[model samples]
Every structure is written in C-alpha cells, then in structure tokens.
Target: MTAPHPQAARHVRAVAVQPHWSAQDFVTAAAFRRWMRAQLDMARPHLNENGVNLVVLTELNGLPLVMRGGAWALRLRTFERVALALFLARLPRTLPILLRERVSPVRALQLADIDANTDLYLTTCRDLAREYGVYLCCGSAPTPRYERRSARLCRQPGLLTNQTVLLDPNGDLIGVTDKVHLTPDEEAGGVDLTPGALGDLRVFPTPAGDLGVAISLDAFRADVIGTLAAQGCTVLLQPDANGAPWTAKEGLPPDPANLRDQPEAWLESSWQVTAQRQIPYAVNPMVVGNLLDLTFDGQSAITGPAEEAPAPRSYVLTAPRPGFLALAPWVTSGEPPALREAGRHRAALSGHPMENQYREATLHADLTLPPATRPAPPRTPHEDALHALLRGEARAARPGRWPWVLAALPLALLARPLWRRRRA
Candidate 1:
C-alpha cells in the first residue's frame, strides 16, 4: 500500500521502545561490557540492510535525515579501561561483541570536561550516522544542546545559522528547508541561546516513501509544524540538543521537564496536524546529561494511525538504560495528584489539551496526556479567604467567599467591642 503523502498517513501509530539496564550494569566491568554488547545485538536485528531501523529519530524539528550507530565501553576512570580490568575474569561472552559497536581509537573525559569533549563526540556522531542506515544520534556530551551556554552564544546574529534537508536511500537528498522561529534568552546550559531567522520548507521524493523534514529546534515551532503539515510530510526528523549539564529532576531550579515541555507542546500541535494530514512524526530524544551512556530515554518515538485511534502503540523503540524513555501512545486511566494541583494554578481549568489532543496542550504542555490536566483543585476555605484578601486584583469566579468575609467581619468587630464593654 502507498500513502498519498506523509500527511496522508495520519492513520499512523505511536510506539515507544526502550532497553531496561540494571544498575549493576554500570559498576561491574566484565558484567557491564557484556550487557552493552547484548543490548546492541538486540537492537541490530531491527536494522535494515542499509543499517536503518524503523525507529523515528527526532527532536523539535530538522530538515533532512541521517543514519549511524556505534558504542563506547569505558570504565569510570582511565585506569579502569587500561590496567585495572576490574571484572574481566567474570564477564560473559557478550562483552567483546559490544566493543565492536564502537570502533574506537578511544578518548576519555571526566564529567568536568564534557564541553571539551564536543569535537570527538560529534565525530563519533558523524561516524555512526554513516555506518547505520538510520540517523544515529550519538555522543553523551552537550546533548539536547538547546540549553547550553554555547547554544546561548548562537543568539548573537551571524554567530549561528542552520539548514534542513531530506535524504534518500542512496544518500541523495530530495529537499532542503530552513527554520522559521527563534526566540531570545532561551535557557541553555545555565545560560541562554539567542534567536535567528526563518529557513526553507518543502517536500522531497524517496524510494521507501516521500519525506518532509524540519532541521532545527527554533525552526520547528508551532507555525513551522503547521506549515509542514499543510504541505504534508509523512516522516519528520528533528535532531536537537540541550547542551546543559545533567542531573536528576529534583536538582535543577527549573525542572528539565519544563525544557522538555517545548517539544511535547509542539508535538501536540504538530501531531494533530500530522494525523489530520496522515503523516508520522519521528522526534529525536533529548539528553539529560553529557555522560557517555547510550541509555536512550522515552524521547525518540514514531507516530501514525492505529486500528482504533492514534496512540503510543505506533512507537518503535526507546533509548536503552540509564537514559531517556519511550512510551507507546496510550491514555492514562486518570490524572495524577500533581496534575490536579497544577490545574488549580491555571487562571482557568478544564477543556485543555495533551500530546494527543489540542486542549491538553493548553499553556502547560507536559500535563496534556493521561490524567487530563487535573481540574482546578477544590479550594480550601482558608485558601479561599487568603485569595479574597489578596485580590487587590483577585477575580475568583467563586463569589461565595466575598459574602462570607463580609458577614464575618461585622460579627468579628462587634464581638470584640462587646467583650471589651463586659470587661469594663
């Protein structure tokens, strides 16, 4: 069967694939190396003859497609890989095979040198992209670079420029596109990346299918996604980087979840336009830290139509282990308590959007799916009073508190006076 356009394939599906890595996989040398190899072997079968896999690789947006694959087997320290050979005597047969994934004349870096490691990291990306048929997103350094100090440096005009293209099986590109949006002081690696101008947009032909690509983060905003949707792009690849240091969700002042919200928000809009247009979206996974762990997360995904509705089942794979996640398109049974709390924070609640819907996407993008943005939490009477007292501009649609305050004020005042008179 042939799709009229990528947009024509809205009856697509969204699927999530990820590898579960045990913590022990990190500490033990022999055991960890063996596990990494097993992971690669597991993933290799899904590859095409050209090394491409059905997985959808992307970020916010990008123009063309690329392919790659590789691996790195390093211990916590230099001595670990060179002399100590900590757990080698006990490693399984799988260990040697895993090292082949990464053809390394290897280089090592500590956590402090993540930035310095950029050149080698990107070279690794280029190599993997060439070897694999699929666009292999590589390197554990400055990923999702959108949040990096270097990215913030891009804001100064003439400092940063980008383009987009669509590549074919022969590695010949069919289309070239540019970005449309750029914002100011966008947070990156504890700093901000500047903005730039719009780029080209159009379609290209491919042997497997026609592809439409959007190349950069800023370029793939709401307007651009809408435009691409209008033109009909079946498969989209967005390779973006955060460039920020890595840490768990609890560490940062502004949660990485907030940074994550940008793409998820766009996908809500883009996915709808994509579904309506019958196209699928391949969003590359964003990284949390620059540590060289190929632990793919839930970010990378595939979206298309389903027998019933378009949901996660369409997803193909997720990053393996100590990394991100990929989830199949499916709705949650109910909203979580946190979402319920957030809804109350909104100026208004209900009738919103999600990764799958328009309303769930409302101002807060991440909370769109599952437990639907919790309806504004039930107001506590004390909070109700505090709000009324603070409303030098408070316009709580709930007016009951006003009369309650008024009725109680007189009683409170009179009771005080009466008690004073009795005492006198």
Candidate 2:
C-alpha cells in the first residue's frame, strides 16, 4: 500500500513502456544509464500530460545494466559476437559445471556484478518514481541472495532468485514479489532457483484499489489470478521479457506459452485471466533486441475489462515497434459501468472463486513515504579490464580439462622410463 485513495473526479493514469536493446547497448553502465534515462524521459512527458499516478516497466528491463562489466563484454566484433553468444547460450547449462566445480568462480564474479547493477537499477527506478511522482513497479531481475535456514530441505545452501520489486512515489521500497513457478529448463540449468507458493498472495493495496503483480508466466496460472481476485484485487500487472516469437494465432484468443517458443499454440493465458477476472490488466513485454541471436519482440498493451456490448473481450492496445505506451484514466472505486452488462453478470455468476473475495485496499493504511535517493558511480576502463581478466580465468577453468590432461601425458611418458631404469 503506497498511495492515498483519491475521491470522486480523480483518476489513476497508468503507463506501460516497452524497452528495446541491441548488441551495442550493453557496452557500459553509463550506456545503459543513458538508454534507460532516454526511455524514462520519453515516457515522462506522456505521464505528466496524461496526469499519470502509476507507471510500470517491463520485466528484466534492467538486464542490460548487468552487462556493464569487462572490455571482453564491452567491445563488439564478429568473432567476439559469436563467442559471447555461445557463452550466454551455455550459461544455463550449468549442471555438469556445477557438479565438476568448474564455473563457480565465474558465476560468483558475474553474480556480484549483476547484483551491483541490479542495486543501481533499483535506485534509478526509485528516483524516477520520485521524480515523476508516480507509483512504480520497477521491474524484475535474477539475483543471488542468502536465504534463512529453516526446517525445509536445502536445495543448495544459497541460490539466485528472480524477483520483482515495487517502489512508491517519493522513492520508498514497497513489496518485492518473487517468481513462484520456474521453467523446467531453468531448473535443470544448475542455477538453483526457489519457487514461490500460490497460497502466499503478494497483493498490495494501492490508491487505485488493490493492486497485484504476476511475473512472466505466473500471470497465466488461473489459480494465481483467482487467488488475487479472491483477495479483491482490481488491477493486475503482468511484466514480461519474452525472447520467443509471438506465436499467438491471428484473430484467435491469446494463451500463455510459459515464455517458451511454441510454434503452434496461441499464448492465451494472460488474456484468458483478464477475460475471466473482468479486471483491468496491463501486459508490458520486452521488445526488439538480440543477445547474440536471441531476439525479443515488442507487444506491450493494456486490455480493458470484458464487455458484452462492444465485443466478447475488452479493448486491447498493442505496441509493435519503437515501443508503445498504453494509457487510460481509471476511477479508483467501484466496478466500471461496462461490467454491468448481461454477459459480464453471467460470467461473474458462473462461479469464479476469486470474484469479490475481500474488501478494498482503501480500508488499509496508506503507503506514505519519506524522501531519499541513491546514485551509482560511473564505469571505469580499469574496472572493465580487471573484470575481463576474471572472465578469461573463468573460461580457462571450465570442466573436462583435456588440455591439462594431454599436456601432462608427454611429461609422464618421459619420466616413466627414467624411473624404471633407476629401479632396475
């Protein structure tokens, strides 16, 4: 809870900004700062003009910031491009490396760098929220953190967690929601991730009513949406960083593809949840980028509630290129008049367990805040070179050390005859 409930005539303006990236974009932290600042600046005028009170950016939008390490990572070249792509493609294939203790140092160094950059990202978003005077759901990122010991089985003493953070206007931290469900590939990839529970609803109170967030594929789960709706949440924000091509069938209802690149299935999970909940839903997905050969598409949009009169579903605004912004004025209290239609009533009566489960967030304490800001230092060439050396060392330490084993073969053969003759 972070905003005061505005009475009649006041509206909550929500904006979803799509972020783009290329190989050149991840050169340095300053470059990332400039890129992020530019996007925020572009949305600022629109936010001000629209009298926006809440702003949301896409998931893992801050990932490029994590690339602000090492000359090897910064300098772009054809061979280096292929090498780096191969390296990234193999990052998730850590199971064998983990068992062999090969990539631990590399991941340790990289995780530290990513964690530092994530801190920078959080601080920047907090400042933006303060500057724009808007409640911001900053974004999500994968970060390694220490977990408290409990009776539960230890999956790995400590591991990385993909988390989404929230900040109120005036730059105060609110709630942090972790991804509950992980892809099977991620599980097998050796980066042990802790999955969140469905019963632990991360619902927060907002001036715009009760607001909830579901990261990436989690939004597609009917139970997740149902639980939130049952908790009386009206606004659902689903932030995504989908590298897969949009395989949603044209002129067909959308379905959730779980962030996998499925060719034949329509990604209808998020849309179906919105359609069922009859609530305002915003989907802000990453767009237009390549990390090596992995490409991301832009399809940011805000879908209105299901309406019987106009059509079977609510209005949808999708952004294709140069990014997109979907803005709409919202009343904090009461259901929209469009939901009063016969079709909506029928849908509601059809028994959705989440519909009207709890009271509104207005009844809770307002998420008041105080003033504070944190700024990060510039990336230096010395630092980059040092990190590059660390990366080199990591590459050399990979498992299946056939190079060392082969080099030792000649020395062992030469020594074997000498030891035998001496013994004879």
Candidate 3:
C-alpha cells in the first residue's frame, strides 16, 4: 500500500466512505472511540492501497457519539409529554452536562451529550488523520464551540454552529467552515444555531488543489458556490447528512431522511455553478440507522467540471444500505477530466433532465450496495409546517398567534381608510 502522498502541487486521490451508524453503536465515549478507530483502520488500508491522499466523510458523522450518554432520553416516544418526563428524570445527569445551566430538555440534550461527543469526535478524527497520513475533512457536527475564561474555569457554550473541521495529513487543525443556512425545519427542530461569516469564507491549499468546503444546503445556494470559485477553489468538498425525508408529501425530501432516490438539490445547483464557473465538486453523505426518528442516506459522488468532453461523467457510489458501508474510490485532479464539457444550467429545486444523466465514469473502484429502505412514519402537522416554511410556501405557523393577528390586520386596514376619509 502506498503512503499518503507528500504534499505537493499535483493531483491527489480521495475516497469517500459511508459509515452506517446508529444510537446502538455508541453507548459510551470510550466505546465510540474504539468503534470509530476500527472503522477508520479498516478504511485506511484500502485508501492507502488506492493511493488516496485525502478522504471526505459525511456531515453529523459524530452524532451517534453524542447519543452515548443520552440514549435513554431517546428511547421514550418523541412526544413532548414523554420528552418532558424523561427530561425531569435525567436532570441530575443533564444539568452538569449543560454546564450547570437551566434550559429546556431538548436544548439540554443538544448542549450536553452532543457537545461531549463532538469533543471526542474531533480528537479521534485528528488522531486518525495523522495516523493514516491522509488529509481529512473529518466530517461535521452541530458542534457547540466553547469559550473558557481560564484553564481552571469551566467552559461555556460560545455558539452552536453546524461546522466542518478540516485536518491536514499531519493531523493539524488547519481550518473550518460553518454552514450558513438552517432550513426553517432545522430551526423548528430546535437547532438554534448561528451562520458562519461570509467574509471569512475560504479555501484550503492542498496537494490536490485548493479545497473549498461547504456543508449540506450551503451547496444549494448560487452565491456560496460562486464565492468558493472566486476564492480559487478548484475542488469543492461537500459534507452532508441531509435530514430531508425520502418521501415528503410535496417538494423534495426533508433533512435527516434525505434519500438517494429523491431529487438532489445540490446536484442541480452545483451543476449550474460548475458549468458556469468551472469547479469540480464532490459530495459525501451520512447513513444513519433510525436515530431521533431520523433516517440518513448516503450518495457519495464526484462531479466533473463542464467543458470540452462529449458527455461529462459523475463518479458515484451506490448508497450504503442499512447496516452496510458505502465506499467509493475517487482520484483528485487539478482539473477534472470533463473540465471543458459544458453543463446545462437548471434551478436547484427542479428535477434533473434526462439528457443530463451522464452516469458513465471511470471504473477505478467498485461501488457498494445501499441499505434496505426504512419506511418513514407519517409527518406531524408541526413537521409539515416546518417543511412548508422551508419551501417558502408559508410562514412559520404559530398556532395561537396567527389567527388573532390575521383577524386584526383586516380591521386595522379598513379603520385606517375610514379615519382618513373623516379627516379629509
């Protein structure tokens, strides 16, 4: 097996591997480290054997670790009453985890165990990156960044950001990119997070080329991709654990349940940008096993640039089926093979056209089978409303407030017109 290439101004090989994770996989931080190390160890040989210099994993890959100490809270039915009961029962454990602050049960869950797992996740990935000698976009998490007054002082949550931390081959914390948009569903789902500053947007210099990082839906926006291109990012690395459900009633699937069969917004959006701007894009998706009633699917792929080829090819790996690993082999180029092939422009939300289905790609490695489909439970009204707001079909539905506000608005408009006539 070849060692990861020494950093240089040349093409590098990359592999995107999907790990099928579940709440059961992580019952404790120690156990999670072992499991993750084993998984990465197994992948390392394959990546090195294939001469891969860099690796990209999916978003929220660290989430199951967050479930380590909080699995019992998840076992209860996800209704508010049951969740409240669990919250009350777990307060002793929860309070310290929340940095001894009082917050709602859901926020407590986000603040406590998730933060612990994120720390472990970062430390473990950093070790693996150095050990394996591969540059790693070590996956992402809704990580709560912390601020500590001193070494002796307890750390407090500075901000919660859906952030991807990048590690160089030597396991150095080189840079990070935080997601800019949270779909309304993400907001309603209790992820009150801040977006990254666009002014600080950047691309990392790598042996493979300038690597631009974007998380999930950030790739759906034209400006984001344009910014990366303008920043001299020749290759785009997108880490996504899409929560979109496979079969939403209307519109595309919502996150955490984002299925491979569903329309890919990133595909449409990235295609347009790569066509117009000339950047190759790669996507890595997370696969989850029914955690938080959330289902994640994997569809890792590398899309070629647009121009000069008869038909552009997108190297793709079949999504990992439930309880399986989805592995794909990728080789980086300073410019993609189809760099000169022109890609057609299309709206992000729209479905891909048949003519654009250019699937033939270099068979450098074998693709894996996707997991069996898990049927999604019916979405509640709240979930539906959140999704509707995300699709721009409606504003957030505040049940008790909107009705009175709607009624008062019409009366106020009519009264204003009448008062104007009297004054005249």
Best by lDDT: 3
Instruction: Provide the global lDDT of candidate 1 against the true structure.
Output: 0.28
Instruction: For residues 1-424, write the lDDT of model 3, one tens digit per residue.
Output: 9897553435456566556555566767777777667656645655645554667776766644535654666565232333344444544544443333444335554554543465567668877887888878877776654432222112234355677877776666656777876654344344445577766567776554577787767776667877887766766777766453222111333454553333234445444445554565443444423343343433455444333222434323222121111223322212322221211111111233521222111111222112212232243332343223223344321111122222222222111110000000
Model 2 over residues 85-179: C-alpha lDDT tens digits? Answer: 43343344322333343334223323434435655666667667777787777767664432212211112223555667666776665566667
Q: Which candidate is the best by TM-score?
A: 3
Ranking, TM-score, top scorer first: 3, 2, 1
Query: 1 or 2, which is superior by lDDT?
Result: 2
**Cα lDDT for residue 191, model 3?**
40
- What tens digits encode model 1's per-residue C-alpha lDDT throughout 161-217? 233323322332233333333222122211122232333455443333334544434
Reference-based lDDT, each prediction: 0.28, 0.45, 0.49
- Estimate the lDDT of model 3: 0.49
Instruction: Rate residue 148 of model 1 by lDDT.
Output: 18
